[model samples]
Target: MEELINSAKALNAKKLVVLCRLEPGCLGPDGIDHIDAFCQVAERALVNFNADICHWCLAPRLDKSLIEIQYSLAGKVLSRDKAIKFISSFEQDLDVIEERFEDKLTQLINQYIARKR
Candidate 1:
C-alpha cells in the first residue's frame, strides 16, 4: 500500500485513494469488523509517507459484493454514516467487478478532490 502511495506521489497526484477487499470471514482488531483491521494495516503502511491526502475505502465483502465501504483520511477513520455518503455516490449496478471497481474508484477520487475545495 505504501508503495502504491509512493507511486501516486511520484506521479504528482494531489490525493491518493485506496480501495481494499477485506478478507472473507476474518476478524479485525475490533474483534468483529474487518474494516478496522484493514484500517490498522493501512495506517501502518502510511507511516513512512505523508498520508494526510490519502483516502481509503474498504469493502467488507469481496470487491464484487461490496457489502460495506469504510473510509479513512490521513489515518483517521471516519464514521460509517460519513463513509456511507461517499460510498453511495459511487454505487451503481455494474456486474463486471473489475470495471465497476475501476469506475467507482475514479469517481471516489474525484469526489475526494472536490471535497478539498
Candidate 2:
C-alpha cells in the first residue's frame, strides 16, 4: 500500500479518492482516471497479476483496513521500493503509513478542484 501510494504521488495524483461503503464491504476504493492507473500498478505489484479495477476493485469479504490502505494509497506513490519496504513492516513504520495516506489527502484536493471547476 505504501509503495503504491508513493508511486501515485510521484505520478502526480492531484486528487486521490476511494469509492466504498461507509462501513467497508463489497464496495472498494476506486479512482476516476489517474487514480485508476495508479492503483492498477499498485495492485499488480502486490499480487503480481493484471486485474480489472473498474470491473471489480472490490472484494466480497475484505477487511476495512485493507480498504483504508487502498483508498489511502491511490495517487501518492513516491517510490515502489520505499512503499513496499514500508508496508512490509507497517507496525514499525508509522511515518510511512502516514505519508502513504496522502492518497486520501489527494482526494480532498480533488473535491476542492471539482468545486472550482
TM-score of each: 0.25, 0.21
Please provide, for model 1 over 14-73, each residue's C-alpha lDDT reduced to its tens digit, 9 standing for 90 to 100.
Answer: 333445655544442332444455445544544433234334445455455553544444
Count of backbone clashes, every candidate in sequence: 0, 14
Residue 106 displacement in candidate 2 (angstroms):
1.2
Best by TM-score: 1
Query: TM-score of the candidate numbered 2?
Result: 0.21
The runs of at least 3 residues in candidate 2 whose Cα sits more than 4 Å from the true structure, single-residue gaps closed, are: 1-92
Q: Name the weakest run of 10 consecutive residues (lDDT summed) in model 1.
A: 92-101
Candidate 1 ranges beyond 4 A from true positions: 1-13, 24-38, 47-59, 62-64, 67-117
lDDT of 2 at 94: 36
Worst 10 residues of 2 by lDDT: 48-57
Residue 41, model 1: lDDT of 53
- Residue-wise C-alpha lDDT for candidate 2, range 1-117, written one tens digit per residue: 999989855653332223232222112233232343344433433231111121113222234453333333444433445544544553344344445434544464455345434
